[model samples]
Every structure is written in C-alpha cells, then in structure tokens.
Target: MRGVVMYAPGDVRVEDVEEPTILAPTDAIIALSATCICGSDLWPYRGADDVDEPFHMGHEYVGIVEEIGDAVRTIEPGQFVVGSFFASDNTCEICRAGYQTSCVNREVLGTTGRAQAQRMRVPLADGTLVATPGIPSDDLVPSLLAASDVLGTGWFGAVAAEAGPGKTVAVVGDGAVGLMAILAAKEPGAERIIAMSRHGSRQRLAREFGATDVVEERGAAGVARIKELTGGLGAHSVVEAVGTQESTMQAIASTRPGGHVGYVGVLHGVELRGDDVFMTHVHLHGGPAPVRRFLPELIDLIWTRKINPGRVFDLELPIDRAAEGYRAMDERTAIKVLLRP
Candidate 1:
C-alpha cells in the first residue's frame, strides 16, 4: 500500500508501506473512502514541530469497514463510518463525561494509524467509529469526512465559547475550523456572528456560514475592531481557531467580562500572560476537541443534508499527489484539500 510520509520538513513523499492489520480485539481495519490534509499537518511540515525521522501522516478520514476484530460489536464489515483523530474507549469515565479525546485508554491516529492510505487499522473500533445511517452516495462522502474531525472540532469550539441565541459570537481565524465554527454558532441560533478574516474568499464563506460582520485586522487592531462592532463591551463569546500568541490574545481581548473563550487551534508557540487572563474574567475551555462526543449529531446533520460543510474542500487531488496537497495548503492556495485514496 502507498501512504504519505514526511521524511523531514518540506519533504513529503508517497511511498509504499506495509498495510495495517488487526492488532487488538477492539480494532478494525477499514478501506478509506476519503481522506484529507489538516491545517495542523503544516506544523511539522513548516518545521514548527520537530521531526527527526520519517513518519506516516493524515488523520481525518471516512471509510468502509473491511474487517473487524472478534471483540468489536458496534462497528462491522461494510458499514461506512466516521471517526475522530483520537481512537478512544468511549466507555471510560472521561469519555462518558463527553471528553472522549481525553479517554483513559486513548490512541493517537494519523501519526500512528497512517490514514492517508488506502486502508488503516482503527483502534478501539467499537468506541471510536460511528457508523453512518447507510452506505452514502459519492456526494455525501466529503461532508461525512468533515464530521470525522474539522466539523466536530469547530462545533466543540463553539460549544466551549457557549454560543447560543441572543449572544454575539466572534471567531478569530478564517481556516476551515473557524468557518465551521460559524456554522456551529448559527446552528444554535446565535445572533450577530462576527468573523475576523483578511482573505476575501474566507470572508465570503464566513458570511455564508452565518457571520454577520467581518473584521479584516488582526492582533490588537482586530481586538479593537471586534469591540467597535460590539459597542465597546466586546462579544459574549469568542472562539480562537488560530493557535498563535497573537490570535489567542486577540480572542481573549475581544471578549467581554464574564464571557467565554474557546481556544481550539493546535498551540505551537503560545504563552498566555497570567495577569492579562486574570484581568479578563473570561471562561476558558478547549483542547484536542472531544470530537467523539459530537460525532453523532454532526453525522446526522450531514446525513440529513441540513449542512454543507464539505464545501470547505476547494482543492481535490489524488492520493499520489499528496505532497502537492500539503504545498497548496501551506501556501494558502486552498482552504482544505481532499485527497482521494
């Protein structure tokens, strides 16, 4: 089988690799129906995160189960499923509390599962994989794939920010996750949604997803703009989808006292000032999104065609051209790249 491997920063290649096998009674092997590149994949690709040697890449996936271990019960062969980046035992105390990403027995995929291939082994199959209503048509594949990670992550960010009716929401990033956050905000009937973005394309998508206002500035200027739009009290809920120091600060500063801030972007070199946060009086919540907790609802929305999150994929490429997909995303030529396996 061929899979993507990052030999080093700026050096991604599709190389033949050994196929995955069921290594645990709770595991299942699935033939990937679709997969895509994540913005966080750029962390190591741009050399932000360390990479001393070659390793498999890609985490977001939607696939058909080809085989299931004897112990697996909920998931079975031939069923189409959506799963998150983390493989977890959904019955754990933490997972039962709606934080499956922090489950007691959790496994990291993408770095270990090598999902950017034709097939991969899913750990804790019964807990991690959620079967779709039925085998979907080709048109539903991308949206189902989005539910696997980005949609769920964005939904988590919005929930963390406590977006809801009669509250103003501000998102501090224009990436796929940020855009999805707009959808999440709108789904819960949030009013006066604001999206902070400089790119015209992303700005348009933000509005399409329910953003009523757009702020082109960033950092302090962006914070000021958000306040200006909110009548100087700041917004009631702010979502930080860009995990940079500047974006994080902007999100916190853009929120009013007693508001909430959801930081979802993968933090690379972020350090929050204690005094600043102390003075802000904002409720903070976010980490690797408990995507599993939201998978059922997100999948239902997609399956019912109530949302079109798949439009986020502006670029599509064959799995063999995965290096190109990474370059396109790194260069910002594409919002999200869908890789056909």
Candidate 2:
C-alpha cells in the first residue's frame, strides 16, 4: 500500500508501505473511502513540533470494513464506518463518563502508520467505530468524514463553552475547527455568535454558520471587540480553537468573569500564568476531543442534511497527491483538504 510519510519539515512524500492486519482480537481492517489533512498535521510539517524520525500522517477517515477480528462482532465486512482519531475501549470508566479520548485502553491512529492510505487497521472496533446506517452517497461522505474529528471537536468546544439558549458565544481562530465551532454554537441556540476572523472568506462562512458578528482583530483589540459587542460584559462562552499563546490569552480575556472557556486547539508553545488565570475567573476545559461521545448525534444530523460541515474541505485530491493537500492547508490556500484513496 501507498501512504503519506513526513521525512522532515516541508518534506512529505507518497511511498510504499506494508499493509495493516488485525494484530488484536478487538481490531478490524478498513479500506479507506476518504481521508484528509488536519491542522494538527502542520505542527510537524512546519517544524513547530519535532519529527525526530519519519512517520505516517493523517487521522480523520471514513471507510468500509474489509475484515474484522474474531473478537469484533457489531461491525462486519462491507459496512461503512466512521471513527474517532483516538481509538478507545468505550467500556472504560472514563469512556462511560463520555471521555473516550482518555479511556483506560486508548490508541491513537496514524502513529503506527498513516490513515491517508488505501487501507488501515482500527483497534477496539466495537468501541471505536460507528457504522453508518448504510453505505451513503458520495455527496455525504465528506460531511460524515468530518464527524470523525473536526465536527466532533467543534461540538465538544461548544459543549465545553456551555453554549445554549440565551448565551453569548465567541470563537477565537478561523480554522476548520473554529468554523465548525461556530456551527455547533448555532445548533444549541446561542443568542449571539461572534467569530474572530481576519480572512474575508472565513468571515463569510462564519456568518453562514450563524456568527452574528465578525471581529477582524487579535490580542487585546479582539477582546475589546468581543466585549463591545456584548456591552462590555464579554461573552458568556468562548471557544479557543487556535493553540497559540496569543489566541489562548485572547479567548481567556474575551469571556465574562463567570463565563466558560473551552479550548480545543492542539497546544503548540503555550504556557499560562497562574495569576492571570486567577484574575480571569473563568472555567477552562478542553483536551483531545471525545469524538466518540458525539458521533451518533452528529452522524444523524449529517445523514439528514441538517449541517454541512464538509464545506470546510476547500481542496480535494487523490491520495497520491497527499503532499499537495498538506501544502494547500499549510499555505492557507485551502481551509481543509480531502484525499480520495
């Protein structure tokens, strides 16, 4: 099989690799129908995160089950499925509490190899994979794929931010996750959704996703804009989708004293001051999104055409062009890139 491998910063290649097989009874093999690049993938591509050795890349995927281990029962050959980036035994105590990403027995996909390939192995099949009602049309594939990661991450952000009826919500960052956060905020009845975006294209999409206001500012200025829109009280909930010191601080500062801050960005070089947080007086929560917890509802929504999170995919290419997909996203020329294997 052929997949993406990162040898170093700005050096991505499509190369031959060994195929995957079920090494665990809980595992299943999937032939990828679709996969895509993620913002987090850029961390190493840009040298922001160390890549001491060449490794596989990509996590978000939607595919068909080709084979299942003896222990796997719920899913079978020919069933289309979507799965979270983090594989977990959903029966764990933490998973039962809706934090599958932190399950006692958890495994991250793509660490062993990339998901941007013709086929891959999924462990803990019964717990980690969600089978679609049936094989979906090609049009629905992208949106279903988004539920595997970004859509779920955004939903988690909204839930963590406490977005609901009568609440004013603000989102920092305009990436795919942030845009989907805007959509998630809307679904829960947020009274006002403020999107912080400097890009015109993103701002337009944010409005379509239910952003009532767009703040084309950053740092203190951005905080001020959010406060101004909220009559100086700040937003009741703020979703931080960019894992930068500036965006984190901006999100913390943009919330009211008693508001909540849900940060989902993969932290890059962030360190928070204790005193600063103490003064802010806001509840903070977020980590690897428990995507499995929200997959059912999100899938239902997508299956019914209630939300179109797949619009985030501004570029689509063959799996052999995975490097171009990565470059398009890194250069900000594309919001998200979809690769067909």
Candidate 3:
C-alpha cells in the first residue's frame, strides 16, 4: 500500500507502506477511497510542529469498510463509512455527554502514518465510523469527506459560539472551516452573518454560505467593520478558525461583550490576555471538534444534498500528486485539496 509521508519540512511523498489490520477486538480496517489535505496538516509541513523524520500524514478520510474486528457487529464489510479524525468509543462517559473528542479511549486517526496508505486501522469501530444511509453516487463523495472534518469543525465552532436565532455572527478566518462556519451559523437561524475575508473568492463563497456582509479589512479595521455593521455592538457570536495571534485577536474584538467566541484553530505559542478576556465577559469554548457527535446529522444533510460542501474542495488530484496538493494549499492557491487513492 502507498501512503503520504512527510520526511522533512516541505517534503511530502507518497510511498509504499504496510497495510493496516484489525489490531483490537473493537478495531476495523478501512480502505480509503478518498482523502484530503487539511490546513492543520500545513502546521507540521511548514516546520511549526517539529515533526520527526518520516512521520505519517493526513487525518481526513472517507472510505469503505474492508474488515471489522470480532466485536464489531453493527458495521460489516463493504459498508461505506465516514469517521471522525479522532476515533472514540461512543459509549464512554465523555462521549455520552456529546464530547467524543475527549473519549477516554480515543485514538486519533492517521497518527500512525498508515492512514494515507490504501488501508488503515480504525479503533473503537462501532463508535467512530458512521455508515452513510446508502451507497452514495460518486459526486457526493467529496462532500461526505468534508463532513469528516471541516464541516464538523465549523458546525462545532458555531455551536460553541452560540450562533442561533436573532443573533449576529462573525467569522474570523476565510478558510474552509470558516466558510462552513458561515453555513453552520445560518443553519441555526442566525439573523446576520459577517465574514472577515480579504480574498475575493473566499468572500464570495462566504456570502453564498449565508454571510450577509463581507469585511475586507484586517486587524483593527476588520474588527471595527464588524462592530459598525452590528451598530457598534459587534457580533453576538464569533468563530475563530486561524491559530495565529492576529486571528484570535480579530475574533475576540469582532465579538461584543457578553457574546461568545469559539476557537478551533490548533493553538500555537499565542496567549490570550487574562485581563482582556475577563473584562470582555464573553463566553469562550472550542477544541478539536467532537466530530463524531455531528457525524450522523452531517451525513444526513450530505445524503440528501441539502448542503453542497463539496464546493470547498477546489482541487482534486491523484494520491501521487499529494505534494502538489500540499503546495497549492500552502501557497493559498487552493482552499482545500481532495485526493483520491
């Protein structure tokens, strides 16, 4: 089998690797038919994470079940499934509370490097993978794959920020997750959606996703635009999708006092000032998205073609062109890259 491997910063190669097998009674093996490059993958690729030599790459995947462990009864071979980036047993205490990302026995998919390979192991099979209602047509594959990560992350961001009826929402970044956050806020009946985007393409997509306004400003000016649109009150909810200090600041400033800020960017060395956050008195919550909890709902939307998240995937290439996909995203030429194995 072949998988994407990162040997050094800016060095991504698709090379032959061992195929995964069911390692536990609750594990399942999936043959990936589709996968994609995530913005988070760029962190290590850009030398931010100090990735060791020859690390396994990629987490977002949608595939077919080739085999299941002895204990896996609900999902059988040949079933098409979409899973969270992190595998969690749905019956755990935290999972029961709808926080599957913190499941006691969680296993992050693809951390073991074999994920980019043709076949990968999925632990806690019964809880992690959600089978689509039926075999989907080929066109729906990309959207279903998005549901595995970006869409789920965006939905979680909106929920964390309390985006709902009669409230104005602001999104801090224009990446795929941020675009989906716009859609997610609209789903919950948010009255007004403001997206901070300088890129014309992203801004257009944001509007299509239900953003009522697009702020082309950055930094302080951008925050002011959001506040100005909301009549100096800022937005009731803000979604932060970029992990940098500036993006976080923009998200906080664009939100009003007593509003909520949901941040899901993989935090780096940046810190939030305690005084500012305390004085703002706004709610703050977000982490690695509990994608498992939203899996079923998102799948239904995709299956029915209610939301066409596949639009976020601007580039498609064979798995062998994985490096090009990474480069396009790194250069900001592509919003998201979809790869087929």
Alpha-carbon error at 5 in model 2, in Å?
0.9
TM-score of each: 0.99, 0.98, 0.98
- lDDT tens digits by residue: candidate 1, 1-341: 98999999989999998899999999999999999999888888999888888989989999999999999999989999999999999998999999999999999884544889999899999899999999999999999898888889899999999999999999999999999999999999998899999999999989998999999998888888888988899999999998998889889999999999998998768898799799999999998999999999998998899999998899999999999999999999999999999
Clashes by residue pair, model 2: none
Per-residue alpha-carbon lDDT of model 3 for 257-321, expressed as tens digits?
99999998776777999988788878989999999999999999889888988889999998989
CA shift of 121, model 2, Å: 0.3
Model 1: pairs clashing at backbone N, Cα or C within 3 Å: none
Candidate 2 positional error at 283, Å: 0.7
- Cα RMSD to native, each candidate? 0.8, 1.0, 1.1
Query: For all candidates, what are the clash counts?
Result: 0, 0, 1
TM-score of 3: 0.98
Predict model 3's lDDT versus the native. Answer: 0.89
lDDT of each: 0.92, 0.92, 0.89
Stretches of model 1 off by over 4 angstroms after superposition:
110-112
Preferred candidate (TM-score higher): 1 or 3 = 1
Candidates ranked by lDDT, best first?
A: 2, 1, 3
- Model 1 earns a TM-score of 0.99
